[model samples]
Every structure is written in structure tokens, then in C-alpha cells.
Target: MHPRIRLELAKRWSEPHREHHDTDHLAEVVRAVDLLASSGMAFDIDTVNTAAWFHDAVYDVHRADNVERSATLAQRWLGPGEGDRIAQVVMATTDHVAATGDVESAVLCDADLSILGADTERYDRYAHAIRVENLHVPDAEYRRLRSRVLARYQARSELFATAAARELWEDQARENLARELTRLGRPVAV
Candidate 1:
């Protein structure tokens, strides 16, 4: 990674309106990718780390095109081949679903979502941060939409696509989602 790119990314993530999608979240995803790579996981570490830095670069809580815009931003800094791959990884975070058979994409997605399995205190802080980011929405509406989003992950048979991620974080992620749903007055789907 170039120093210039790192500096640019830091600036983008430091935007004042960002609450959850700030530099801290970017660092967490990068750290998660590093941890996964250190554990002997076979994937392109550079691509995953690059994707992590640019994934939320264009975040806008009220905008639906953040993922697409983020991918486009990647193209400006990365070469065609690497940029395309990073774009795909960035887009994958939008749905937390990777392209079938794409290991790098799976790893990137898992790293981006690592927050879901964070311990109770950290998870609580993440939840609070997200709520702050979406403060424009009414409390009831926020709860409704947030519940749906969390339930979507909870209802999935597997929260993580990577084997290591599933083994390490699946149970905890499910527990966190379930507890959050309960607090939101949304019944956890069976």
C-alpha cells in the first residue's frame, strides 16, 4: 500500500458525519484480515487489505449507492486488475455475500463483518455507533429497519463464508444478533 493512498483513505474515513464507518472501523477490518492471514489462511493479503481500506470510503448513511461509489473510488487509486478485484470485495460488503468460489471476496466480507462477533461491550458500542450514524431515522423506524438487517444475518445458515471465520465467529455472531433483536422487540427468526 502506498503512503499516499493510506493518507487519502484516512482523510475519507475521518469525515465528520461518520460514526460507525470511521477510521476505527477501517482499522478493525484491516486488523481482522491480518489476523486471518496470520492464521495460515490462503488468500491474497494485499487485495484484502486494500479492499478493507476502500470498502467504506464513500459511506453515506442515507445513500443507497455507497458501495458502487466506493468501488469507483478504488478504480482511481488502484490499477485495473487490482482495482477490479478490490471493487468486487468492496461491493461484497454491501450484502455480506461473496461471489461463489471467490476466496478473497469471502475473506474481505468476513473481515468487514467481524464486528458482529465482537464481545458484548464492543458489540454494544458498535450497535450504539450505528444508531448514532442513523440518527436521522425515527427511533421506531430505526429499530424496525435495524431489526430486519440483523435478522437477515441471523436467519442465514452461515453468517460467515470463510471456514476459519465460521469456526471462530459464527456462534458468537448469532448470539449477538439474537440478543440485539430481542432488545429491539423483534422476535429472532427460527
Candidate 2:
């Protein structure tokens, strides 16, 4: 990665109000992608890494266009071919829905969502961290919105796109989501 791009990404993710979407989260995703690649999963590592670094580069709780803005930022910094690939990968994080046959995008999506399968303590912290990020919202409203978001993921037949990710994370991710939903006073899906 270019030093300038690294610096810019650092600056954006370092925003004081960000709790879960900070540089640490970016590093975690990068590490996850690297691990998957090292295990012989075939994908454009460079593009995946680039996308990981920029995926949450423009996070805003109130903004639905953060993914588009992040994609544009990637294009601006990385230029066409690679940038476009990175942008597509970043966009995949918007809904965590990679197109069929797009392994690279699937890997990127899996990497971004890896935290969902973390241990109970860590997952709890992640949930709290997100609440902190959206601190402006009332508790009840946040719970409702957060429940809806988790429900969307839970409703998916497959939570992780890549086989490796699915094998490793699917069950744990579903368990974690159910736990969270119960905590939020929402009924978990069967």
C-alpha cells in the first residue's frame, strides 16, 4: 500500500467517535483475509487487502451511502483496474452479499464479517462497541434497528460466502446473533 493511502485510511478510521469501525477493525479484516489466502484460498489478495483497508473508511451511522463513498475514495486513491476491483469488494460489504462465482468478493465479505463469529466476550464487546458508535440514538430505537440488521443476516441461508468461512464461522455466527437478539429483547429465528 502507498504511504499516502495508508495515512489517509488511518486518518479516516481514526475518527474519535468510531468504536468498532476503527483501524483495529480494518487490521482484523486484513489479517483474516491474509489467513484465508495463506490457507490456499484463491483470490486476488492485493485487491482483497485494498478493499479491506477502505471498506469502512467512510463509516457514518446516519449515512446509508458510506459504502459508495468508500468505493469512490478507493477509486480516487488507487486508480482504475485495481481500484475498481477494490471498490466492488468494498461494495460487497454493504450487504455482505457477494455475487455468485465472485470468489474474491466473497472472501472480502467473509473477512469483513469475521468478527461475528468471535468468542462470546469479544462478540459482546463488539455489540457494545457498535452501540457506542451509535450513541446518539435512544436505547430502544437502537435495539430495534440493531435487531433488524441481525435478523437480515440470520435470515440468510448461508451467512458466510466462502466455503472456508462458512465451515469455520457459520454456526458460531448464527449462535452469536441469536444470543445478541435475545439480549436486545427480540425473538431469535428458529
Candidate 3:
């Protein structure tokens, strides 16, 4: 990536309204992607790294179109071909599930969600930051909605698509999600 683009991304990620979805989170995802690459995974490192930088570039807890908007931002900034490739990867964050055989998407999604497998203290911090991001919502509504979204993730057959990610995060992510759901007074669904 060019120095100019990296600088621009750093500015966008540092926007004041952000909480968990800020520069630190961006760095964590990049680190996660690097970790995956160091494991000798077969995905295109540059492609996935580009996607990671732009994945949450337009994060807004109130907006339902963040993924699409992020993709558009990438296309606008990076231009047609390369931007479109990265945009396709950015769009996968909408659901955090990759189509089978899409190694780059799998890598990007896994890296983006790496926090879910963080240890309790860090995971709690991340959860708190997320709540902070959406503090505009009433407490009860937030709990209800958050629980549903987490349950959907829990219900998925696999949270991490790549074998490397599964080895690193899968079990811990399941435990963390279950613990959080219980804390929310929502039954932890399998």
C-alpha cells in the first residue's frame, strides 16, 4: 500500500465517534492477518491485507449500510480493479461468513473477528467498547438485539473459516460467546 493511502486510512480509523472499531481494532485485525500468514496459509497476503484496512473504514453503529459504504469507499479510494477486488473482501464482513474455497475472504473475516477469541479481560473490554459505541440504544433494547446477533454467531457450525484461525480462536470464541450470552441473561444457544 502507498504511504498516502495508509495515512488516509489511519485518519479515518481514528475518527472520534469510534469506540472498539477504532485504530487499535484496525491494528489488531492487521496483526491477526499477519499471524495467519506466518502460519504458511495459502491466501494472497496483499489482497487480504488491503481488505482488512478497508473492512470497517465506514463503521457507524447506527447505520445498516456500513458494509456497502465501506466497500464503496474502498473502490473510490483505490480505483476500479484493485479496489473492486478488495471491496469484494470488505463486503464479506457484512455477515462474517465466507463462501467455501474463498481463502482470502476466509482470512479477512477471521482476522476481523479475532477479538471474539481474546481472553476474558480483553474480550470484556471489547464488549464494553461496543456497548459504548451503541449507547444511543436503550439498555434493554441493546441487550435484546446484541443477544440475538451473538446467538446467530454461536449457532453457526464454525466461527472461523480457515484451519489456522480455527486452531487459534474457535474453542475460545465459543466459550467467550457462551459466557457473554449467559451474562446477558440469554440462554446460550448451541
Task: Report the lDDT tens digits of candidate 1 across residue range 105-153.
Answer: 8999999889999998999999999999999999999999999999889
**TM-score for every candidate vs. truth?**
0.96, 0.96, 0.97
Where does model 2 exceed 4 Å of error?
Answer: none
Lowest lDDT 10-residue stretch of candidate 2: 162-171
Candidate 2, residues 1-190: lDDT per residue as tens digits? 8988999899999999899999888888988898788878988898788788899899888888999999999998999887888888899888999999888889999998999988889889999999999998999999999999999999999998888888777889999999999999999889
lDDT of 3 by residue, 1-190 (tens): 7889988988889999999999999889999999999999988999998998899888888899988999999999999999999999999899998887889999999999899999999999999999999999999999999999899989989898888999999999999999999988899766
Candidate 1 vs 3: which has more TM-score:
3
Query: What is each predicted model's overall lDDT from 0 to 1?
Result: 0.90, 0.90, 0.92
lDDT of 3 at 66: 89
Candidate 2: give the clashing pairs: none
What's the true lDDT of residue 89 in model 3?
Answer: 91
Total clashing pairs for each candidate: 0, 0, 0
